[model samples]
Target: MKRLSLLLAGALLLQLQASEPSVFGAGNLDSDSPYGLTESEKKIVENRQNLKNTKRKSQENSAQLQSLRERIDGLQTIIEGLAEKTQENKLKVTELTSGEDIGAQRDAKIAALEEAVRADEANIASLKSLLESMATQVDAINANYVSKDEFNALVGEINAFKRDLGKTLKSVSAPAAGASLESKSSKELAAEAKASYNKLYFKDAIPMYEELIRRNYKPAYAHFMIGEMWHYRKEWSKALSYFKESAARSSKTSFMPTLMLHSAECMMHTGDSANAKKFLRSLIAKYPASGEAAEAERLLNTL
Candidate 1:
Protein backbone atom coordinates (compact mmCIF):
# COMPACT_ATOMS: atom_id res chain seq x y z
CA MET A 1 0.00 0.00 0.00
CA LYS A 2 2.86 2.53 0.69
CA ARG A 3 4.62 1.59 -2.57
CA LEU A 4 1.40 2.17 -4.62
CA SER A 5 0.92 5.54 -2.98
CA LEU A 6 4.51 6.60 -3.79
CA LEU A 7 4.03 5.43 -7.41
CA LEU A 8 0.86 7.44 -7.77
CA ALA A 9 2.59 10.59 -6.46
CA GLY A 10 5.52 10.06 -8.80
CA ALA A 11 3.13 9.61 -11.77
CA LEU A 12 1.33 12.84 -10.90
CA LEU A 13 4.62 14.71 -10.62
CA LEU A 14 5.77 13.40 -14.07
CA GLN A 15 2.50 14.36 -15.68
CA LEU A 16 2.70 17.97 -14.32
CA GLN A 17 6.31 18.23 -15.43
CA ALA A 18 5.42 17.06 -18.96
CA SER A 19 2.49 19.48 -19.25
CA GLU A 20 4.40 22.55 -17.97
CA PRO A 21 7.22 23.98 -20.20
CA SER A 22 10.72 24.85 -18.96
CA VAL A 23 11.89 28.46 -19.09
CA PHE A 24 14.47 27.63 -21.91
CA GLY A 25 11.98 25.54 -23.99
CA ALA A 26 10.79 26.66 -27.43
CA GLY A 27 7.09 26.96 -26.22
CA ASN A 28 7.99 29.00 -23.10
CA LEU A 29 6.71 32.65 -23.00
CA ASP A 30 10.20 34.01 -22.24
CA SER A 31 11.92 31.99 -25.11
CA ASP A 32 12.60 33.09 -28.62
CA SER A 33 10.91 30.70 -31.10
CA PRO A 34 9.38 30.64 -34.62
CA TYR A 35 5.75 30.49 -33.15
CA GLY A 36 6.35 32.41 -29.91
CA LEU A 37 8.72 35.37 -29.21
CA THR A 38 10.61 36.70 -26.10
CA GLU A 39 10.29 40.20 -24.66
CA SER A 40 13.69 41.17 -26.18
CA GLU A 41 12.44 40.10 -29.66
CA LYS A 42 9.28 42.20 -29.26
CA LYS A 43 11.43 45.14 -28.19
CA ILE A 44 13.67 44.66 -31.27
CA VAL A 45 10.55 44.62 -33.51
CA GLU A 46 9.31 47.88 -31.93
CA ASN A 47 12.74 49.48 -32.41
CA ARG A 48 12.71 48.53 -36.10
CA GLN A 49 9.20 50.09 -36.50
CA ASN A 50 10.40 53.25 -34.76
CA LEU A 51 13.47 53.42 -37.07
CA LYS A 52 11.18 53.16 -40.17
CA ASN A 53 8.94 55.96 -38.86
CA THR A 54 11.99 58.16 -38.16
CA LYS A 55 13.32 57.55 -41.68
CA ARG A 56 9.94 58.54 -43.24
CA LYS A 57 9.78 61.72 -41.09
CA SER A 58 13.38 62.60 -42.04
CA GLN A 59 12.55 62.25 -45.77
CA GLU A 60 9.44 64.45 -45.34
CA ASN A 61 11.42 67.10 -43.44
CA SER A 62 14.13 67.08 -46.12
CA ALA A 63 11.48 67.67 -48.81
CA GLN A 64 9.98 70.56 -46.82
CA LEU A 65 13.45 72.11 -46.28
CA GLN A 66 14.19 71.86 -49.99
CA SER A 67 10.84 73.50 -50.81
CA LEU A 68 11.58 76.34 -48.37
CA ARG A 69 15.08 76.82 -49.84
CA GLU A 70 13.62 77.07 -53.36
CA ARG A 71 11.08 79.66 -52.21
CA ILE A 72 13.81 81.74 -50.58
CA ASP A 73 15.88 81.63 -53.80
CA GLY A 74 12.88 82.75 -55.85
CA LEU A 75 12.23 85.66 -53.46
CA GLN A 76 15.88 86.73 -53.74
CA THR A 77 15.67 86.81 -57.54
CA ILE A 78 12.53 88.98 -57.38
CA ILE A 79 14.20 91.37 -54.97
CA GLU A 80 17.15 91.80 -57.33
CA GLY A 81 14.87 92.58 -60.26
CA LEU A 82 12.97 95.14 -58.21
CA ALA A 83 16.21 96.80 -57.21
CA GLU A 84 17.30 97.13 -60.84
CA LYS A 85 13.94 98.62 -61.84
CA THR A 86 14.14 101.18 -59.02
CA GLN A 87 17.57 102.29 -60.21
CA GLU A 88 16.32 102.69 -63.79
CA ASN A 89 13.39 104.85 -62.64
CA LYS A 90 15.71 107.17 -60.71
CA LEU A 91 17.90 107.66 -63.80
CA LYS A 92 14.85 108.49 -65.93
CA VAL A 93 13.73 111.15 -63.47
CA THR A 94 17.13 112.80 -63.59
CA GLU A 95 17.12 112.79 -67.39
CA LEU A 96 13.66 114.39 -67.52
CA THR A 97 14.71 117.16 -65.13
CA SER A 98 17.71 117.96 -67.30
CA GLY A 99 15.54 118.06 -70.41
CA GLU A 100 13.17 120.55 -68.74
CA ASP A 101 16.06 122.90 -67.89
CA ILE A 102 17.30 122.81 -71.49
CA GLY A 103 13.80 123.62 -72.76
CA ALA A 104 13.56 126.69 -70.52
CA GLN A 105 16.92 128.02 -71.76
CA ARG A 106 15.84 127.52 -75.37
CA ASP A 107 12.62 129.45 -74.77
CA ALA A 108 14.52 132.41 -73.27
CA LYS A 109 16.91 132.52 -76.22
CA ILE A 110 13.99 132.42 -78.65
CA ALA A 111 12.34 135.41 -76.96
CA ALA A 112 15.50 137.52 -77.36
CA LEU A 113 15.75 136.55 -81.04
CA GLU A 114 12.10 137.53 -81.63
CA GLU A 115 12.69 141.04 -80.25
CA ALA A 116 15.62 141.44 -82.66
CA VAL A 117 13.39 140.40 -85.60
CA ARG A 118 10.82 143.08 -84.79
CA ALA A 119 13.48 145.83 -84.83
CA ASP A 120 14.77 144.58 -88.18
CA GLU A 121 11.25 144.81 -89.65
CA ALA A 122 10.95 148.46 -88.64
CA ASN A 123 14.32 149.26 -90.20
CA ILE A 124 13.33 147.44 -93.38
CA ALA A 125 10.15 149.49 -93.69
CA SER A 126 12.11 152.71 -93.31
CA LEU A 127 14.59 151.58 -95.96
CA LYS A 128 11.79 150.74 -98.40
CA SER A 129 10.27 154.20 -97.96
CA LEU A 130 13.66 155.80 -98.68
CA LEU A 131 14.09 153.69 -101.78
CA GLU A 132 10.68 154.73 -103.13
CA SER A 133 11.50 158.41 -102.63
CA MET A 134 14.82 157.99 -104.49
CA ALA A 135 13.07 156.20 -107.36
CA THR A 136 10.63 159.06 -107.69
CA GLN A 137 13.47 161.59 -107.73
CA VAL A 138 15.32 159.64 -110.42
CA ASP A 139 12.17 159.60 -112.57
CA ALA A 140 11.91 163.40 -112.22
CA ILE A 141 15.58 163.84 -113.25
CA ASN A 142 15.06 161.59 -116.30
CA ALA A 143 12.02 163.68 -117.42
CA ASN A 144 14.15 166.88 -117.53
CA TYR A 145 15.59 166.07 -121.08
CA VAL A 146 19.10 165.15 -120.00
CA SER A 147 22.02 163.96 -122.24
CA LYS A 148 22.18 160.23 -123.09
CA ASP A 149 25.46 159.71 -121.19
CA GLU A 150 24.08 161.43 -118.09
CA PHE A 151 20.82 159.53 -118.37
CA ASN A 152 22.64 156.20 -118.77
CA ALA A 153 24.94 156.88 -115.78
CA LEU A 154 21.98 157.92 -113.64
CA VAL A 155 19.98 154.85 -114.68
CA GLY A 156 22.92 152.54 -113.92
CA GLU A 157 23.29 154.01 -110.41
CA ILE A 158 19.56 153.79 -109.81
CA ASN A 159 19.43 150.16 -110.96
CA ALA A 160 22.43 149.25 -108.80
CA PHE A 161 20.75 150.87 -105.77
CA LYS A 162 17.50 149.04 -106.53
CA ARG A 163 19.37 145.71 -106.69
CA ASP A 164 21.03 146.27 -103.34
CA LEU A 165 17.74 147.43 -101.79
CA GLY A 166 15.96 144.34 -103.14
CA LYS A 167 18.60 142.06 -101.61
CA THR A 168 18.21 143.75 -98.21
CA LEU A 169 14.45 143.36 -98.37
CA LYS A 170 14.75 139.66 -99.28
CA SER A 171 17.10 138.97 -96.35
CA VAL A 172 14.80 140.70 -93.83
CA SER A 173 11.88 138.62 -95.10
CA ALA A 174 13.72 135.24 -95.06
CA PRO A 175 13.26 134.07 -91.46
CA ALA A 176 9.65 133.84 -90.33
CA ALA A 177 9.87 133.06 -86.60
CA GLY A 178 12.10 132.28 -83.61
CA ALA A 179 12.63 128.70 -84.76
CA SER A 180 14.22 129.90 -88.02
CA LEU A 181 16.55 132.25 -86.16
CA GLU A 182 17.51 129.63 -83.57
CA SER A 183 18.14 126.94 -86.16
CA LYS A 184 20.33 129.32 -88.15
CA SER A 185 22.08 130.70 -85.02
CA SER A 186 21.73 134.51 -85.04
CA LYS A 187 25.22 135.02 -83.64
CA GLU A 188 26.82 133.04 -86.47
CA LEU A 189 24.75 134.95 -89.07
CA ALA A 190 25.79 138.28 -87.55
CA ALA A 191 29.45 137.31 -87.71
CA GLU A 192 29.09 136.25 -91.34
CA ALA A 193 27.41 139.58 -92.21
CA LYS A 194 30.23 141.57 -90.58
CA ALA A 195 32.82 139.57 -92.49
CA SER A 196 31.02 140.25 -95.79
CA TYR A 197 30.74 143.94 -94.97
CA ASN A 198 34.52 144.15 -94.37
CA LYS A 199 35.07 142.90 -97.95
CA LEU A 200 33.37 146.12 -99.24
CA TYR A 201 30.99 144.16 -101.50
CA PHE A 202 28.29 146.53 -100.26
CA LYS A 203 25.59 144.98 -102.44
CA ASP A 204 26.38 141.47 -101.11
CA ALA A 205 27.04 142.79 -97.57
CA ILE A 206 23.75 144.71 -97.37
CA PRO A 207 21.50 141.63 -97.38
CA MET A 208 23.50 139.72 -94.76
CA TYR A 209 23.80 142.79 -92.54
CA GLU A 210 20.08 143.45 -92.85
CA GLU A 211 19.46 139.83 -91.87
CA LEU A 212 21.67 140.29 -88.81
CA ILE A 213 19.88 143.51 -87.86
CA ARG A 214 16.58 141.65 -88.27
CA ARG A 215 17.80 138.88 -85.96
CA ASN A 216 19.45 141.26 -83.44
CA TYR A 217 17.71 144.67 -83.35
CA LYS A 218 20.66 146.42 -81.67
CA PRO A 219 22.95 146.41 -84.76
CA ALA A 220 23.56 150.15 -85.07
CA TYR A 221 26.38 149.45 -87.56
CA ALA A 222 23.77 148.12 -90.00
CA HIS A 223 21.71 151.31 -89.77
CA PHE A 224 24.80 153.46 -90.33
CA MET A 225 25.68 151.53 -93.49
CA ILE A 226 22.19 152.02 -94.94
CA GLY A 227 22.37 155.77 -94.27
CA GLU A 228 25.85 155.95 -95.83
CA MET A 229 24.67 154.07 -98.94
CA TRP A 230 21.78 156.52 -99.51
CA HIS A 231 24.07 159.48 -98.83
CA TYR A 232 26.60 158.25 -101.42
CA ARG A 233 23.82 158.16 -104.04
CA LYS A 234 23.14 161.88 -103.40
CA GLU A 235 19.46 161.17 -102.60
CA TRP A 236 19.32 164.06 -100.12
CA SER A 237 15.84 163.41 -98.66
CA LYS A 238 16.40 159.69 -98.49
CA ALA A 239 19.85 160.15 -96.93
CA LEU A 240 18.44 162.47 -94.22
CA SER A 241 15.63 160.00 -93.47
CA TYR A 242 18.07 157.07 -93.02
CA PHE A 243 20.56 159.15 -90.99
CA LYS A 244 17.78 160.20 -88.60
CA GLU A 245 16.59 156.59 -88.35
CA SER A 246 20.16 155.42 -87.65
CA ALA A 247 20.63 158.02 -84.91
CA ALA A 248 17.41 156.91 -83.21
CA ARG A 249 18.20 153.21 -83.64
CA SER A 250 21.75 153.66 -82.22
CA SER A 251 20.41 154.93 -78.88
CA LYS A 252 20.53 151.32 -77.68
CA THR A 253 24.05 150.70 -78.97
CA SER A 254 27.69 151.89 -78.56
CA PHE A 255 27.63 153.90 -81.87
CA MET A 256 25.50 156.78 -80.57
CA PRO A 257 28.24 159.42 -81.20
CA THR A 258 28.85 158.34 -84.77
CA LEU A 259 25.08 158.19 -85.43
CA MET A 260 24.60 161.78 -84.14
CA LEU A 261 27.50 163.17 -86.20
CA HIS A 262 26.19 161.53 -89.37
CA SER A 263 22.67 162.80 -88.68
CA ALA A 264 24.07 166.37 -88.45
CA GLU A 265 25.82 165.87 -91.78
CA CYS A 266 22.54 164.66 -93.32
CA MET A 267 20.77 167.80 -91.96
CA MET A 268 23.50 169.98 -93.50
CA HIS A 269 23.07 168.25 -96.91
CA THR A 270 19.27 168.72 -96.74
CA GLY A 271 19.85 172.53 -96.38
CA ASP A 272 18.52 172.62 -92.78
CA SER A 273 21.32 174.87 -91.46
CA ALA A 274 19.49 175.96 -88.35
CA ASN A 275 18.65 172.37 -87.33
CA ALA A 276 22.19 171.27 -88.20
CA LYS A 277 23.65 173.98 -85.97
CA LYS A 278 21.23 173.09 -83.19
CA PHE A 279 22.24 169.36 -83.43
CA LEU A 280 25.94 170.33 -83.51
CA ARG A 281 25.55 172.45 -80.35
CA SER A 282 23.75 169.61 -78.59
CA LEU A 283 26.47 167.14 -79.68
CA ILE A 284 29.17 169.39 -78.21
CA ALA A 285 27.27 169.86 -74.97
CA LYS A 286 26.47 166.15 -74.44
CA TYR A 287 29.65 164.55 -75.79
CA PRO A 288 32.51 166.96 -75.02
CA ALA A 289 35.16 164.23 -75.14
CA SER A 290 33.87 162.65 -78.37
CA GLY A 291 35.35 163.11 -81.89
CA GLU A 292 31.95 164.37 -83.05
CA ALA A 293 32.09 167.27 -80.51
CA ALA A 294 35.55 168.37 -81.83
CA GLU A 295 34.22 168.25 -85.40
CA ALA A 296 31.18 170.26 -84.40
CA GLU A 297 33.35 172.96 -82.83
CA ARG A 298 35.41 173.23 -86.06
CA LEU A 299 32.25 173.39 -88.16
CA LEU A 300 30.79 176.16 -85.92
CA ASN A 301 33.99 178.19 -86.23
CA THR A 302 33.84 177.88 -90.03
CA LEU A 303 30.12 178.90 -90.12
Candidate 2:
Protein backbone atom coordinates (compact mmCIF):
# COMPACT_ATOMS: atom_id res chain seq x y z
CA MET A 1 0.00 0.00 0.00
CA LYS A 2 2.88 2.41 0.84
CA ARG A 3 4.63 1.59 -2.48
CA LEU A 4 1.38 2.49 -4.36
CA SER A 5 1.16 5.89 -2.55
CA LEU A 6 4.81 6.70 -3.49
CA LEU A 7 4.15 5.83 -7.16
CA LEU A 8 1.07 8.13 -7.41
CA ALA A 9 2.93 10.96 -5.62
CA GLY A 10 5.86 10.64 -8.14
CA ALA A 11 3.39 10.90 -11.04
CA LEU A 12 1.80 14.06 -9.54
CA LEU A 13 5.27 15.59 -9.02
CA LEU A 14 6.23 15.02 -12.68
CA GLN A 15 2.98 16.59 -13.93
CA LEU A 16 3.45 19.63 -11.59
CA GLN A 17 7.06 20.15 -12.97
CA ALA A 18 5.78 19.96 -16.59
CA SER A 19 2.94 22.47 -16.00
CA GLU A 20 5.15 25.04 -14.12
CA PRO A 21 5.31 28.63 -15.48
CA SER A 22 8.40 29.52 -17.55
CA VAL A 23 11.31 31.27 -15.73
CA PHE A 24 11.21 34.08 -18.44
CA GLY A 25 7.53 34.81 -17.78
CA ALA A 26 6.82 37.94 -15.75
CA GLY A 27 4.93 35.94 -13.08
CA ASN A 28 5.21 35.95 -9.21
CA LEU A 29 4.28 33.04 -6.86
CA ASP A 30 1.40 35.06 -5.19
CA SER A 31 -0.15 36.54 -8.44
CA ASP A 32 -2.10 35.01 -11.38
CA SER A 33 -0.54 34.84 -14.88
CA PRO A 34 -1.48 37.57 -17.53
CA TYR A 35 -3.49 34.88 -19.39
CA GLY A 36 -6.52 33.38 -17.58
CA LEU A 37 -5.87 29.81 -16.31
CA THR A 38 -7.96 26.82 -17.71
CA GLU A 39 -9.61 24.33 -15.36
CA SER A 40 -6.80 21.67 -15.88
CA GLU A 41 -4.08 24.36 -15.54
CA LYS A 42 -5.57 25.54 -12.25
CA LYS A 43 -5.61 21.93 -10.96
CA ILE A 44 -1.91 21.55 -11.87
CA VAL A 45 -1.07 24.84 -10.10
CA GLU A 46 -2.70 23.62 -6.83
CA ASN A 47 -0.87 20.24 -7.03
CA ARG A 48 2.49 22.06 -7.46
CA GLN A 49 1.86 24.13 -4.30
CA ASN A 50 0.93 21.00 -2.28
CA LEU A 51 4.15 19.21 -3.39
CA LYS A 52 6.37 22.12 -2.15
CA ASN A 53 4.73 21.95 1.34
CA THR A 54 5.21 18.12 1.59
CA LYS A 55 8.97 18.39 0.71
CA ARG A 56 9.58 21.07 3.40
CA LYS A 57 7.89 18.93 6.13
CA SER A 58 9.93 15.80 5.07
CA GLN A 59 13.27 17.74 5.45
CA GLU A 60 12.31 18.96 8.97
CA ASN A 61 11.37 15.38 10.05
CA SER A 62 14.78 14.02 8.78
CA ALA A 63 16.70 16.53 10.96
CA GLN A 64 14.63 15.52 14.07
CA LEU A 65 15.35 11.78 13.46
CA GLN A 66 19.16 12.46 13.23
CA SER A 67 19.05 14.36 16.59
CA LEU A 68 17.18 11.42 18.26
CA ARG A 69 19.88 8.94 17.08
CA GLU A 70 22.68 11.05 18.62
CA ARG A 71 20.80 11.17 22.01
CA ILE A 72 20.41 7.34 21.98
CA ASP A 73 24.21 6.88 21.41
CA GLY A 74 25.04 9.16 24.40
CA LEU A 75 22.66 7.18 26.65
CA GLN A 76 24.32 3.88 25.61
CA THR A 77 27.79 5.17 26.66
CA ILE A 78 26.43 6.10 30.15
CA ILE A 79 24.92 2.59 30.56
CA GLU A 80 28.34 0.96 29.79
CA GLY A 81 30.06 3.15 32.43
CA LEU A 82 27.45 2.21 35.10
CA ALA A 83 27.91 -1.53 34.32
CA GLU A 84 31.72 -1.28 34.85
CA LYS A 85 31.19 0.52 38.20
CA THR A 86 28.79 -2.24 39.36
CA GLN A 87 31.43 -4.96 38.62
CA GLU A 88 34.11 -3.09 40.62
CA ASN A 89 31.74 -2.79 43.61
CA LYS A 90 31.08 -6.57 43.50
CA LEU A 91 34.89 -7.25 43.75
CA LYS A 92 35.20 -4.91 46.78
CA VAL A 93 32.30 -6.73 48.53
CA THR A 94 34.03 -10.12 47.87
CA GLU A 95 37.26 -8.89 49.49
CA LEU A 96 35.40 -7.96 52.68
CA THR A 97 33.54 -11.32 52.81
CA SER A 98 36.80 -13.32 52.47
CA GLY A 99 38.14 -12.16 55.90
CA GLU A 100 35.17 -13.68 57.87
CA ASP A 101 37.00 -16.99 58.47
CA ILE A 102 39.70 -15.20 60.47
CA GLY A 103 37.01 -13.62 62.70
CA ALA A 104 35.41 -17.03 63.22
CA GLN A 105 38.77 -18.51 64.35
CA ARG A 106 39.31 -15.64 66.80
CA ASP A 107 35.82 -16.15 68.28
CA ALA A 108 36.55 -19.86 68.76
CA LYS A 109 39.76 -19.04 70.68
CA ILE A 110 37.90 -16.62 72.97
CA ALA A 111 35.25 -19.26 73.73
CA ALA A 112 38.00 -21.74 74.76
CA LEU A 113 39.53 -19.22 77.16
CA GLU A 114 36.12 -18.53 78.79
CA GLU A 115 35.65 -22.28 79.26
CA ALA A 116 39.02 -22.58 81.06
CA VAL A 117 38.09 -19.73 83.43
CA ARG A 118 34.83 -21.49 84.30
CA ALA A 119 36.73 -24.72 85.07
CA ASP A 120 39.03 -22.89 87.48
CA GLU A 121 36.01 -21.35 89.23
CA ALA A 122 34.54 -24.83 89.74
CA ASN A 123 37.84 -26.02 91.33
CA ILE A 124 37.77 -23.04 93.69
CA ALA A 125 34.27 -23.97 94.83
CA SER A 126 35.45 -27.52 95.62
CA LEU A 127 38.43 -26.19 97.57
CA LYS A 128 36.14 -23.99 99.72
CA SER A 129 33.99 -27.01 100.69
CA LEU A 130 37.18 -28.88 101.61
CA LEU A 131 38.19 -26.03 103.96
CA GLU A 132 34.85 -26.21 105.79
CA SER A 133 35.38 -29.98 106.28
CA MET A 134 38.87 -29.45 107.68
CA ALA A 135 37.60 -26.94 110.26
CA THR A 136 34.98 -29.45 111.46
CA GLN A 137 37.63 -32.19 111.76
CA VAL A 138 39.92 -29.92 113.78
CA ASP A 139 37.13 -29.06 116.25
CA ALA A 140 36.25 -32.75 116.77
CA ILE A 141 39.92 -33.74 117.35
CA ASN A 142 40.48 -30.93 119.90
CA ALA A 143 37.46 -32.11 121.92
CA ASN A 144 39.10 -35.55 122.38
CA TYR A 145 42.19 -34.03 124.13
CA VAL A 146 40.24 -31.94 126.73
CA SER A 147 39.45 -33.26 130.28
CA LYS A 148 35.83 -34.42 130.82
CA ASP A 149 34.99 -31.53 133.21
CA GLU A 150 36.53 -28.93 130.82
CA PHE A 151 34.74 -30.50 127.86
CA ASN A 152 31.37 -30.30 129.64
CA ALA A 153 31.85 -26.61 130.47
CA LEU A 154 33.03 -25.81 126.91
CA VAL A 155 30.05 -27.66 125.39
CA GLY A 156 27.56 -25.73 127.59
CA GLU A 157 29.09 -22.35 126.60
CA ILE A 158 29.21 -23.28 122.88
CA ASN A 159 25.57 -24.40 122.90
CA ALA A 160 24.44 -21.15 124.54
CA PHE A 161 26.44 -19.05 122.05
CA LYS A 162 25.16 -21.04 119.06
CA ARG A 163 21.54 -20.33 120.01
CA ASP A 164 22.23 -16.64 120.57
CA LEU A 165 24.26 -16.30 117.34
CA GLY A 166 21.49 -17.82 115.24
CA LYS A 167 18.93 -15.44 116.79
CA THR A 168 21.19 -12.39 116.45
CA LEU A 169 21.49 -12.69 112.66
CA LYS A 170 17.71 -13.00 112.23
CA SER A 171 16.59 -10.43 114.84
CA VAL A 172 18.94 -7.66 113.65
CA SER A 173 17.62 -7.83 110.05
CA ALA A 174 14.34 -6.09 111.07
CA PRO A 175 14.08 -2.28 111.33
CA ALA A 176 13.26 -0.92 114.85
CA ALA A 177 9.51 -0.35 115.51
CA GLY A 178 9.78 3.48 115.55
CA ALA A 179 12.57 3.83 112.97
CA SER A 180 11.98 6.02 109.84
CA LEU A 181 13.51 3.53 107.38
CA GLU A 182 10.46 3.66 105.08
CA SER A 183 10.66 7.47 104.89
CA LYS A 184 14.21 7.40 103.49
CA SER A 185 15.50 6.36 100.04
CA SER A 186 17.64 3.19 99.79
CA LYS A 187 20.71 5.30 98.89
CA GLU A 188 20.18 7.51 101.94
CA LEU A 189 19.86 4.44 104.15
CA ALA A 190 23.05 3.02 102.62
CA ALA A 191 24.93 6.24 103.41
CA GLU A 192 23.71 6.18 107.02
CA ALA A 193 24.74 2.52 107.33
CA LYS A 194 28.21 3.30 105.91
CA ALA A 195 28.65 6.16 108.42
CA SER A 196 27.78 3.82 111.31
CA TYR A 197 30.16 1.16 109.94
CA ASN A 198 33.06 3.63 109.70
CA LYS A 199 32.54 4.57 113.36
CA LEU A 200 32.79 0.86 114.30
CA TYR A 201 29.16 0.91 115.45
CA PHE A 202 28.37 -2.55 113.99
CA LYS A 203 25.29 -2.93 116.18
CA ASP A 204 23.69 -0.01 114.30
CA ALA A 205 25.16 -0.68 110.78
CA ILE A 206 24.37 -4.43 110.62
CA PRO A 207 20.60 -3.95 110.76
CA MET A 208 20.57 -1.11 108.16
CA TYR A 209 22.77 -3.07 105.79
CA GLU A 210 20.64 -6.16 106.37
CA GLU A 211 17.56 -4.05 105.54
CA LEU A 212 19.28 -2.98 102.28
CA ILE A 213 20.07 -6.61 101.48
CA ARG A 214 16.38 -7.47 101.98
CA ARG A 215 15.46 -4.64 99.57
CA ASN A 216 18.01 -5.84 97.00
CA TYR A 217 19.63 -2.41 97.10
CA LYS A 218 23.39 -2.82 96.58
CA PRO A 219 23.21 -6.26 98.27
CA ALA A 220 26.75 -7.21 97.25
CA TYR A 221 28.34 -4.14 98.86
CA ALA A 222 26.21 -4.57 101.98
CA HIS A 223 27.37 -8.18 102.31
CA PHE A 224 30.98 -7.13 101.76
CA MET A 225 30.85 -4.47 104.51
CA ILE A 226 29.27 -6.93 106.95
CA GLY A 227 32.03 -9.39 106.11
CA GLU A 228 34.59 -6.60 106.65
CA MET A 229 33.22 -6.02 110.19
CA TRP A 230 33.59 -9.71 111.04
CA HIS A 231 37.09 -9.75 109.53
CA TYR A 232 38.12 -6.79 111.76
CA ARG A 233 37.05 -8.77 114.81
CA LYS A 234 39.27 -11.70 113.58
CA GLU A 235 36.17 -13.86 113.21
CA TRP A 236 37.51 -15.55 110.04
CA SER A 237 35.03 -18.45 110.19
CA LYS A 238 32.04 -16.05 110.26
CA ALA A 239 33.48 -13.52 107.81
CA LEU A 240 34.06 -16.19 105.13
CA SER A 241 30.32 -16.81 104.78
CA TYR A 242 29.47 -13.13 104.13
CA PHE A 243 32.47 -12.81 101.74
CA LYS A 244 31.20 -15.82 99.77
CA GLU A 245 27.73 -14.29 99.69
CA SER A 246 29.12 -11.00 98.34
CA ALA A 247 31.15 -12.78 95.67
CA ALA A 248 28.14 -14.86 94.63
CA ARG A 249 25.99 -11.72 94.27
CA SER A 250 28.47 -10.00 91.94
CA SER A 251 32.10 -10.74 91.04
CA LYS A 252 32.65 -7.33 89.42
CA THR A 253 32.88 -4.70 92.13
CA SER A 254 35.03 -1.67 93.11
CA PHE A 255 35.92 -3.49 96.35
CA MET A 256 36.78 -6.81 94.62
CA PRO A 257 40.55 -6.17 94.93
CA THR A 258 40.20 -5.61 98.68
CA LEU A 259 37.64 -8.40 99.02
CA MET A 260 40.11 -10.83 97.41
CA LEU A 261 42.92 -9.66 99.68
CA HIS A 262 40.82 -10.17 102.82
CA SER A 263 39.43 -13.49 101.53
CA ALA A 264 42.98 -14.88 101.24
CA GLU A 265 43.76 -13.64 104.72
CA CYS A 266 40.56 -15.29 106.02
CA MET A 267 41.60 -18.59 104.43
CA MET A 268 45.06 -18.46 105.99
CA HIS A 269 43.59 -17.87 109.49
CA THR A 270 41.12 -20.74 108.98
CA GLY A 271 43.96 -23.26 108.41
CA ASP A 272 43.77 -23.42 104.56
CA SER A 273 47.14 -21.95 103.60
CA ALA A 274 47.31 -23.89 100.34
CA ASN A 275 44.00 -22.44 99.05
CA ALA A 276 44.98 -19.04 100.52
CA LYS A 277 48.20 -19.04 98.47
CA LYS A 278 46.33 -19.95 95.28
CA PHE A 279 43.71 -17.16 95.83
CA LEU A 280 46.41 -14.55 96.67
CA ARG A 281 48.33 -15.45 93.50
CA SER A 282 45.13 -15.14 91.43
CA LEU A 283 44.39 -11.75 93.05
CA ILE A 284 47.92 -10.52 92.35
CA ALA A 285 47.65 -11.57 88.70
CA LYS A 286 44.20 -10.03 88.30
CA TYR A 287 44.89 -6.64 89.88
CA PRO A 288 48.65 -6.15 89.44
CA ALA A 289 48.66 -2.34 89.77
CA SER A 290 46.24 -1.96 92.71
CA GLY A 291 47.39 -1.48 96.35
CA GLU A 292 45.37 -4.61 97.26
CA ALA A 293 47.50 -6.55 94.79
CA ALA A 294 50.66 -5.42 96.62
CA GLU A 295 49.15 -6.63 99.88
CA ALA A 296 48.16 -9.94 98.22
CA GLU A 297 51.75 -10.41 97.01
CA ARG A 298 53.12 -9.97 100.58
CA LEU A 299 50.40 -12.25 101.98
CA LEU A 300 51.13 -14.94 99.33
CA ASN A 301 54.80 -15.16 100.49
CA THR A 302 53.69 -15.92 104.09
CA LEU A 303 51.17 -18.56 102.85
Q: Per-residue lDDT for 1-303 in model 2, tens only?
A: 999999999999889977986545533434655335566666777888777675455434333333432332233233333334444444444554555655766566555555554554454344434433433443453355323342343334333332332233233334452277767789999998886554344656777888899899999999999998778667897888899999999999999988888888899999999888888889889999986787787677665
Error of 2 at 47 (Å): 99
Identify the runs in model 1 with alpha carbons over 4 angstroms from their true place: 1-183, 219-221, 232-236, 250-252
In order, the Cα lDDT scores of the candidates are: 0.57, 0.63
Local error of candidate 2 at residue 75 (angstroms):
98
lDDT of 1 at 94: 54
* Model 1 residue 96 distance off true place after TM-score fit, in angstroms: 65
Please report the candidate that would top lDDT against the real structure.
2
Ten-residue segment with the worst summed lDDT in candidate 2? 161-170
> How many clashes show up per model?
0, 0
Clashing pairs in 1: none
